[model samples]
Target: MLAPFLIMLREGLEAALIVGIIAGYLRQTGRGHWLPAVWIGIFLAVALSLFTGAAIQLLATGFPQKAQELFEALIGLLAVAVLVGMVFWMRRVARSIRTELHASVDAALAGRDGAAWALIFMVFLATAREGLESVFFLLAIFQQSPSAAAPLGALLGLLAAVAAGWAIYAGALRLDLRRFFRWTGVFILFVAAGLLAGSLRALHEAGLWNSLQQVVFDLGRVLPESSPFGTVLSGLLGYREAPTLGEVIVYIVFLAITVPLFLRPQPAARLGRVTDV
Candidate 1:
């Protein structure tokens, strides 16, 4: 529950920030009349996300149990991929996203090939990537944890992001976006590690991978997933009372490989942070 909440909050806030920046820049440049095109882009992006997520869900419902397991595994993989990509991409672009976005906006508005359509497409493309990333991650979580709390947490996270974005746009909030994104990127790596383990388990269930089926250890007697606290851990961290050897290996390997990559700040970001100090 907490995992999904944070995931949506961070990702949604990123998207919101992008849109806010674009809109703010447009207004500052005295091109406020073009704002409607931005809104249209946002609407279309939302529609695309909804349509894509729904179609994927609908398609998965027709699969057999084995196929469903495979599907879950595939979705988990994709979610992890997108999550990792977003984290690093943001890291690389955080310092210059504003400049790049401003340039794009300028070009779009100055273009002769339908400026409105260009602006709309630009915003839609940007926002839609975040939306689809959220959708894939949400699907992975929803599949792993079936409780209503999953969706509820996601809704609250999105609402919080919207409020935060609005506050930032209104100049009421002065967030240190670098620290925020850096910490969340670390957290997301952990989340993706869990998902990777969960994906391995799903593949095993689907009979695609059969090696290392031995249980590493059983903690069911001391902390069963049915317990309230255990349920929370299970939902948030992919806690398993008796995980298989393959699952354990996958989880450990993911963290070992990804954590350092996440922690190692880009030289430019490090310099910017230092200069800010």
Candidate 2:
């Protein structure tokens, strides 16, 4: 539940931020009339995301057990890849996103011919990227944990993101986006590592991966995933009471490789920018 919540929150917030920046730029430059076009693009992008998620869910329900496992494994792998890419991409663009967005807005509105269409397409592409990322992550989470709470958490997270975005846009809130993203990026890396391990487990269950089948340790007696605390840990950190050797190894290796690179000091070229939003 917590994992889905945080993932959705981060993804939704990123989209909201993009929309806010575009809207803000348009208003600041006396192009507020373009706001309607922006809204249209957002609506279309959101519809597409919802339709895609629903279609995938319906299709997965009809698959055989092994096929289901394989599908889940594939979704988990895709989610991890998308999550990792999103974290790094945001880090790389955080410093210049505002400037780049402003420039894009200028370009979109530069031509009188189909200027509104250009702006709509620009906004659609930006928001759709974030929306599609959220859809994949949410699907992976839902597949792993089939509980009512997970969807509720995702809804809450998205609502919170919308509120936060509105507050920021209305000048009612001042958040340190740099610190927010930095810490969340670290948190997400852990989440992605867990998802990666879970994906490997899914693959093994699907009969597609059989190596490293030895059990690492049995904590089921001491900390069963069914326990309340253990469940929380599992939801947040992908904790497994009796993890296989491969799962443990992959989990550790993933963190070892990603944590340092993520925490390393940014290059000067990526620093010294106002990223308050």
For each predicted model, how many residue pairs clash, with residues at least 3 apart or on different chains? 0, 0
lDDT of candidate model 1 versus the reference: 0.89
Cα error of candidate 2 at position 67, Å: 0.8
What candidate 2 gets wrong by more than 4 Å, as runs, is none
As for model 1, its CA RMSD to the true structure in angstroms is 1.9
The alpha-carbon lDDT assigned to residue 162 of candidate 1 equals 95
User: TM-score of every model?
Assistant: 0.96, 0.98
Let me know the TM-score candidate 2 reaches against the reference structure.
0.98
Candidates in order have lDDT scores of: 0.89, 0.90
lDDT per residue (tens digit) for residues 64-111 in model 2:
999999999999999999999999988889988988999999999898
Question: Lowest-scoring 10 consecutive residues by lDDT in candidate 1?
Answer: 268-277
Which pairs clash inside model 1?
none
lDDT of 1 by residue, 1-277 (tens): 7988898999889998999989999999899999999999999999999999999999999999999999999999999899899898887777778878899999898977799999999999999999999999999999998899999999999999999989988888878888888888988988888888899999989999999999999999999999998998887778899999998998888889888987874675334531121
Residue 5, candidate 1: C-alpha displacement in angstroms:
0.9
